[model samples]
Structures are given as C-alpha cells and as structure tokens.
Target chain A: MTQLREPLSLISECGLPAALEVMGERWSFLILRAAFNGFVHFEDFSSELGIARNILSNRLARLVDHGVLARERCEHDKRKVEYRMTDKGRELLPAILALRDWGLRHSDSAAPNLVLVDARDGKPIAPITIRAHDDRVLEWGDLAWAEPGDVATAPAEACAEEA
Target chain B: MTQLREPLSLISECGLPAALEVMGERWSFLILRAAFNGFVHFEDFSSELGIARNILSNRLARLVDHGVLARERCEHDKRKVEYRMTDKGRELLPAILALRDWGLRHSDSAAPNLVLVDARDGKPIAPITIRAHDDRVLEWGDLAWAEPGDVATAPAEACAEEA
Candidate 1:
C-alpha cells in the first residue's frame, strides 16, 4: 500500500477585500484623490467631485474614523476644520497611484487627463510595478502563492504566462 | 492693474473613478481575487464567498459587462458557464496586487496570512513602488499634477522628504 500527501494549499488572504470594504466606494476613492491633491475643506471636495454636502460629510467622517484621515481644527480659523492624511492614509498612496496609472494608460479618454509629474524634474513618474528584490520586473507568470510558515522550498509556478 | 492669468490647473482624470464604478463594490473585488486565483465556475465563487446566488449572479454579470471578465460556456459541461479574466481585467493586476500587499503589510492579522512569492526562485516579490524614469524611488514629496499641455519647464519640489 502507498500513501500520497496532498500538497498543502495556501489560503487566500482577504487584506485587499478588507481595504475595499473601507475605501473601495466610488466617492471614497475620489475624496481621497482630492485630498491627495491638496483639497482639505468640505467645500473643496464638494466642488471638485460635484458631490452633495451630505454625501461628502459622510465620506469624510468615515475616512477619519478608519484612521485614514485626521480631522483637526484649522489653525487659521477656529471655526473651521481641516482633513489631512494620516500615516495610515499615506500608506495607501501606492495602491491609489497604481490605480491611477492603470487608468491613465488603459482608459479611453476623449479629453486630456491630468498627468502625474515629478515635482523636481517635470518628467512623468514611471508606472508602478512588482519587481523582485533583485529588481527584476515580474509578471503574473513570475508569481505563486505560499502559505505562511511553509518550508521555503523553491516555489512552483502558480500558472503559465498568458499569451 | 492687469488681469492675472490663472496658473494652468490640471484636471483630475476620471479613469480611477470609472474603475471603481465597475469593481469598487465590496464583493466585486473579492470575486476578482478568486478569479485571479483560478476560480471560474459560479459554484466556486458561491462557495468561496458564501454570497447569495442572486447577488453573485448580479456581480458576475456586471463584471462581464464591464469587460473585466469574460463569460463562456464550460468545455467540460455543455450547460455550465465559466468566467475568465479578459485582457482588460488582467491589466488591473498591479493595482489589485498593490492593495493586497498593503493589506498584508499593514493589516492587524496576528496569524500567518497568504503571501505572494516568486514562481521562479520562491522568493517574495518586492513591494510595489512609484519610481522615476531614471529608476529613482519616489515619495509623495516627489509628485505633483501637471496640466497635459503645460510647458516642459523643470518642476519644483512638491514637498520635503518624510522621515
């Protein structure tokens, strides 16, 4: 008699889903986009996104509660509050920029879209990519999933490269 | 006094919002995650997400309509259908992977979670980054928006580096 151990399958992590749960809504990302572009007051986001005041208030409050944005009393005006990105919120920039870059490259826009440039050089920033620690550019083919704590045998290919 | 020319303010692009409009819903991204991991049949998504059938049906249809997923008859079964990621869908990997990577690095998970590894060498992929044309690593301070047709003059620094 012979026995064969089934290969251990890695569990799919839900971190991305959890993120989407918090900021994946249409208005939320746009609000974040506006904030990144220096829009802090409620009126700015409202005018920029054309969103109603009530909706903007709800979205901003939710972001603040999630620790993505901080609501502090405006230093210049005691009666006004300003929203700024917290450290947690700043960590989200890569993902946001990834989406923005994808949209810029893949979208079918009839009108010219805003271009992201280096603040120092005026050149457009490069696309976001997954590179090896050795700096090799990786495609989906170059990836596989591993269960945490698994013995680090050479990982097998997850799938073949798409044509 | 002469009228002043308003500095050319760049218009924020809408592609990211359009993307969110398609796959920004809570469950939609989860479904895409499953698809990227090789889930295709309706039953697989149903079991994995534990979502109601009607809701799943709606989400799948929406994804198909948005060109993110393609619907085709299952080869193994004449009556069953399978969903596959289209080229447009595949292009979204950087963004999705960015979100996943962030969640893995920043989430409050106390236990081991799934990890993405190099299919070739079994090493973990590097974190996604915003880079310059010369391959210099970039930060928030290194970026700013430019109008599409703005002069190609050198840009000034957006902000100072963070610690």
Candidate 2:
C-alpha cells in the first residue's frame, strides 16, 4: 500500500467531511431512505418516519438546498408539492446500500424484515464491493494512494506480484 | 421496478437505523478515516483531527463498545494504547469511499489534494457500483424488492425483457 506520509494533510482535503456535513445525522439518512422507497409527499415522510413536522421540514429543506432532493409542485395539482431525488441524490445509492448492508451484517438487532432483490430474478442483490478498473475484486490491502504521475508507470502485474 | 406497497413497514425494520446509531456522527467518521490512513495512536488522532480530548475519548470508547474498533495496549510500549480497526470497521470502507467520492463531486470546495489509487497499477480506483449477481451493473431503476421465495421462480431473462 502507498504510504500516507502526512495523513493529516490528506484528511483535511478529503471530501468525507463535506459529505458528512450534509448527511451525518440520522434523520437525514432515514428521510433519504424514505424518498428512495417512493414516498413523495410531506405527509408520507412525516407519518412513515415518525419524524416531527418541524424536524422533517428542516431536513427536507436542507436536502433541497444541498441539491440532494428537488422540491417541485405536483404536475396535476399545483398546490400539492413533491420531494424527489435529483441526479446527485440518486448517486448516493451506493453509499446508502453499503451502510444498509453493513448494518444488516453487524447489527445484533432483529433479522432484516425485508430484502433488496433484483426485479428480474427476484433474487437478493449482491453485496456492494470495491473493484479495480479491470473489474478485479479488491480487498483493503489491495488499495493504495500515489502521485498522479506514478499511476502511468506502474505495471498491471504489480498486484499479482504483491499477492 | 417492484413497488414498495408498504414502504414504511420496510423502513421501520431496516438496518440503516442501527448502523447510524454507531456511525452517524462527524467526528467518529473522521476518526475512522484516520484509522484507514494508518493512524493508530491516540495522539495521532488528536493532533491530526484537532478534536477536543474529551470528545475524542468518548467517540473512541463508543466505537470500541460497538466493535467497530479494538483498543489494545501497544506491543512495543505496553504503557501506551492503540486503537485499530476491526474486521467490521474495515467493511465500512465502501461506504466511506462512496461518501468521499460524492463529496468530491458535489462539495463546492477546493480540488482534492490527494487521490486513492490501485497500488498494483497506481491508477485511480473506479467508482463504486451496484452489480447484479451475474455481475451486470445496475442503476436505480434496475433494483426492486420481492419476497424471498419469488426469487427462484423469476426468470433470468426478466431483466432483459424489462429493459
């Protein structure tokens, strides 16, 4: 693995902090999950999440402000509003799924009441994985950081040799 | 797509809530990131993160209690302690990477100062993806939930037909 000579410097510039600012809290994530489940109306989020009206309102507004969810008027009824996931919001699916999967494996609580399946085969979805550019499955030891210029010179066989 | 006839019912039992209970805070995640970067000593986390001593102590204990990290006495210097990621903590890599990637794209901040690379070839890592059991890449529309028994009866060609 490539050593981080100054880990602090790298950590400061990392995007995780910003992502956490928008999504670190519990309610926000629960709301996003509800949105993924196709709940659009304010009432749907409020009732389903058991979130207080004020807190739900705050989270929805924050999501909208951050471009994670879009706020728009209902097409048929101008007075009715809907909260929908934007492209950016949709991109978070992997992160959400990873967390959900981790929880399922690690949580000592009740067994999962539902499973995420492939609609085509109705089979459970495969666990999320980290893959190399060549589609090789990668474990933690397989990852490293390097200077941009170093990438081009490194050989594809390097991994094989390391293994 | 399989409709969530009762979305709330599923959300109520999701593992996400439990996962969030352990990892839903900003500092905990930052600490975990530091761990991934190879920082193990208490001072390493403290000085690198500039976190308050008391807060850091609390978060570390919580992580230890949840089994996300293991606290051990330093082998070389038994008087000193080190906090290391356990297998469960290592499993969170995908989730952390996903968030970091999302932030890099969405955060209105400075360009990333570092990049995650494949040690073998030194190339940048690929984006995290949701893949089918057969290794087909899946998008949000491609996903659905169904009863466990329905999985075996569903045709492999079902996805092709829907597409």
Candidate 3:
C-alpha cells in the first residue's frame, strides 16, 4: 500500500478552524519562510525549497487568496512574477523570527549553520531577542535580536548553568 | 486582474526542511500543544483546538503514522482510539518549546491567544526565552523577540507598553 507521509488537513466544516488550518501543512510555512528569505521568483522558491510544481502552484495561490503575500512581474522578464510579503504576511514575521530563534537555540553547532547577524556590522544577535508589543517594542528586551553571524549559547547548558 | 501569492510546500520533501516545514503550521503545532495541554480523544482535540473533525482525524492518523504519537483502542470504548505521545513525540519537546517560545515572543496578546504558562504553576514562564548563540549571547538589545509575552520584564511594563 502506498503510504501518505505528510500531515493531512483538519477535517471539518469550520472556517475559523480553517483560518489556522491552511498554515498547518508543513509546506505552508516553508513557502512563507522562503519568501521572507528573499526567494520571490516562482522557480527560485520551487527549486530552493524543492517543492513539487503542482503543490507549489496551489499553496502560493491559496496564500495570496488569504492575503498573506503580494506578487509582481519583473519588467525585464515578463514571464517571472516576484512574490513579496504583505503587511498581514509581514505580521507573521514574529512567527518566523520565533522559528529562527528556535532553530538557533536547538540546532546550535550544526555545521554550515544558518545564523542571523546584523547586516551592517556583521555581528551576532541574541540574549537581547526582540519582542513585539504591538507595532512597537513591548519592553526593553523586545529589542533583543541576533545579528547575521551571532550565535546563542547552547540551550542545554544555559538552563543548567543559569539555574 | 488578480494578484498572485507566493505558495507554500516544505512537507512533501524530506529532511529537517520538511520536518520544520510541516510542523511549522499553526494548527499542527496547536493541536500538538492542545494534546500537551491534556486533550486526548477526538472530540477533546477538536473542541479545544477548534479544528474540524476530518482534519483532526487526518492529522492524528498522520501523526501516529509518523511515530510521533501512538494510539490504543479505548479499553472502555472499543470504538474510540486514545492518543498519547510516544518517546518520539515527547522528544518533540524541543520543537514545541521552540514554537511556544516563538509564539510567546510574537503571537498577539488579544484573541485566541497562544499563551502557555505552566499549567502546573500560574506564574508565567520567564527568563527562559530561547536564544541564538555561538558562545556569546546574540545581541540585538531590544529587537530580539517579536512578542511582548516573552519579555522577562515586569508584566505591567510589558503588557501595557506601547508597541
């Protein structure tokens, strides 16, 4: 028998549930994350994410339909439509940053790691991790962030040491 | 003319990308979170998460298939399958911790809040926020987290602070 390896959608008739439902699939966030990472072109997103063309088409359109993204065609290349984040989508940056922060904490020491650093100075961001109050800083700590190359302390030992 | 949206799909692929992609969805983790919060039966999972039954069914089955969770026919009710996290699923603590850490850091304070204070203790989890490090703490100072809930500062300052 052919095995279905991925998570199936929440099976029901509630739109409110569906609101969070669409984001439940594994592919959904990867797609969203890629857009944030600057992979806007269809081919670039598809290839880098290694997602199937058909599924990619469906998910992308659905995200747009839900108002999470905006797109445009390159003037030089009429065939290419570039995808960008919308205000609503950008609102999801908290979620993305959360994930990136999570990844940095848990996957620390991964070879060829993906780390966030300040673009201007090329320093690391951390301890000072950002927290959003509304459209502004929630506290002095919300301003905390890791720069492009900055790495956080290993989580396992951090807790133990701090404790 | 209609605007286009970038698509989502990281699940169908394999490796940590697919793992992160699939688990990154809202309902997926929320459902898991609900389970962690103590809802086991289909109805409980549905009721608490506000997810549809069909989607819940599919997700549960898929989670079991992935070995992240295990199921047993309810001894008292043969027709019902009770779900429990397997060691594999429990091991997902890091991932879920990452999610909540992110949610607390970014999720809105209003409406269906993604709050996760210890059910055991009323005191909100603080100073345990995740960090990205490479020996030294990443320093974004105030821009680190995206949500006010994660800030370790006093509640009045954090909750009432202007965003």
Best model number under lDDT: 2
Q: Return the DockQ of model 2.
A: 0.41
Q: What would the per-residue lDDT of candidate 3 be over residues A24-123, giving only the tens digit for each residue?
A: 5546777887776667888987787677899988888878876778877888989989888876665455345554444433343333223344333333
Task: Sort the predicted structures by TM-score, highest score first.
Answer: 2, 1, 3
Model 2 lDDT, residue A74, Cα:
99
Scored by lDDT, model 3 comes in at 0.50
True contacts kept of each: 0.59, 0.66, 0.06
Task: Give the Cα error of residue B96 in candidate 1, in Å.
Answer: 0.9
CAPRI quality of model 2:
acceptable
lDDT digits (tens) for residues A5-114 of candidate 2 = 23346444888877887887548888898899899999888888777899888889989988999999999998888999998899899899998888878967665656
**Runs off by more than 4 Å, candidate 2:** A1-8, A109-111, A153-163, B1-8, B109-111, B153-163
Better of 2 and 3 by TM-score: 2
Candidate 3 C-alpha error for residue B29, in Å: 3.6
State which candidate, 1 or 2, has the greater DockQ. Answer: 2
Highest-scoring model, TM-score: 2
Sequence-dependent TM-score of model 3: 0.49
For model 2, residues B62-137, the per-residue Cα lDDT tens digits are 9998899999999899978999999999999999998888877897776666677777877767777777776566
Task: Tell me the RMSD of model 3 versus the true structure.
Answer: 13.7
